[model samples]
Target: TSIPSLPGISTMESLREAMPYFELILDSGCSQRARQFLCTLLEPECQPLGSSVTPPCRNTCKVVAEECSDFIINILDLSQIFKCDNYPDSEDECINLARGDQCFSKETSCGDGSCIPKRWKCNGVLDCKNGIDEVNCTTCNKYQYACESKDSCIPLEWRCDGNADCEDGSDEINCHQEEEMVMHSHASPCPAGELRCVDGRCITLQQICDGNKDCSDGADEANCRIQYKS
Candidate 1:
């Protein structure tokens, strides 16, 4: 005889109550794909409890039914697993997971229940507490370079600039090698008494300690220390 469908998972509370049964299914030698699908359904329960949201739970159930249909056919019924009287019926009642904070006209929700501006997503900064906003981003903005870990984004001009702008130091790695490769090909060099900046520009020594920046790379004003002679 076929097993009866498990209780509805339309709410976090119900989902939590159903976990042990799911775990039983997992331990009973379910296929790897079925196990992963079950884990996705259980993810929200793993999060800290907050104001209950139905859309994400419902969406997850939909994915399980569509993607794991064959695997779940005899083991569980999708209709009973997804049924929840409390599920939102009206569009207005469902909160948008992608909605931004009040300050931002557009926002996206993080896995941790925090909201951030849509523009901040995949911009390289970990605005979300769990860094979920920047995860799985395949591309970056124009003139922006993706970090070596691909977890963040930086400006293209920041690459190979002798500064560790990326969290992983990818922006400065191999910078000297690149400079050595192009040094002989470039005609730019400092004049006799001027210091050469990282960007190959020349500036007077006096400009180095005058509380002003003369080089595009700002190398002239960095690491200035006063010297004394007895």
Candidate 2:
């Protein structure tokens, strides 16, 4: 069962006043009171701004279901592509779109004889049944492709060779390359006095110079002079 919404009287003037105070405090490095107030606001089981029935909120300040969704969608479109009014809503129109002159191209020879419109280009999955939607994604090979397999795929590479191929190189996944572990020229398998290599990579020496001896050949203090004062 849905919980009943609480209501309250919140004039635009009250929201305006509250907004300014909160914004000013946020702008200033927070004080203890401010932090406590923010903590309460961020608490999971907090109540709405008013009791009984909540006051209406604006787009950015909205608590309304549809307005809130549209507001968030608007904000999201600033950085990411969102399907908009320009998209064809009719299924027939979308299906026939490929046959129209608007989808023509002589330069690209796609698998299904046609390609996705240049405007729609990231290839996560195919939009067309023939998989012609991913025309530009067929180049990966040599560097260990995931699927640069058959002659039918454009760039003639990613066609199913039991392996994938692409050179930003993401097709053949998790083929980890082994890096050769280099031993320092001064390294004696057993070291003394925290004496390890420091060519800038921060590899700490395995041995320590506590006194007497540690690294087989007193390599820790071999050439040092000791002075004692009473």
Candidate 3:
């Protein structure tokens, strides 16, 4: 069900508790699409194939969020739960009101008024009609790997070093190496108890998996299981 949805409200109790916050938004009339958007999340229409509930379109979420940014962020204190960037920008099978074409959150607009997923921008493939998405884009050199999330690149050795050097974690997503094997780069000699990064940087054993990228290549905090203190 959409109750235990992407915001980590995983039970009926949590959904009930969160209802008042949404109700406030409904009462405020912050955006025209707020009611429909909120209802779609609350009681979703199920897909026939896998009984999956399709989420609201990223554009719809973006529209509402932009119009109601002040209320949602300052008053209700709900920016963390209402991140529009979490939604997919693809127009395929997602829920959106019947309107003229427009760009939404996590999407980039082509020069010819067409919208493409933001991830497709600067991906080396020409997805835009006028190629504006690729224009002025930062191309990574041979020694660097381009990050799909933004127009930036990290060192080639940073990929799959157990740390997410790329902001979107694309560098660490499909890594094939084991974590234990990845820990030992063997590139440089450390002072007895430290691990050597692929680029010859040394970090202490306590720094490993400690929720911080100590090494420049991010070998310190790779494959971590982030959890609550309780």
Which has the greatest TM-score?
3
**Regions of candidate 1 where Cα sits further than 4 Å from its true position:** 1-135, 186-230
Candidate 3, residues 1-230, lDDT tens digits: the string is: 44543455666766676678788888987666678778888777766976667777776676567556556643232464568776666767567542337665556677565565566677566766568877888876656766656578887677667898877786675343224534667755676545577767766543554446677767555554321111
Ranked by lDDT from best down, the candidates are 3, 1, 2
Runs in model 3 deviating more than 4 A are: 73-80, 98-230
lDDT of each: 0.48, 0.29, 0.62
Better of 1 and 2 by lDDT: 1
Cα lDDT for residue 32, candidate 1: 28
Name the runs in model 2 displaced over 4 angstroms.
1-81, 84-90, 93-98, 102-114, 118-124, 133-230
**Model 3 RMSD in angstroms:** 12.4
Model 2's lDDT to the true fold? 0.29
Cα RMSD to native, each candidate? 18.9, 22.3, 12.4
* Model 2 agreement with the true structure over 20-88: per-residue lDDT tens digits: 444554455422223322232323244478633221111111111211122222231221111223223
Pick by lDDT: 2 or 3, better one: 3
Q: Using Cα atoms with residue i matched to residue i, what is each candidate's TM-score against the true structure?
A: 0.23, 0.20, 0.40
State the weakest 10-residue window (summed lDDT) of model 3: 221-230
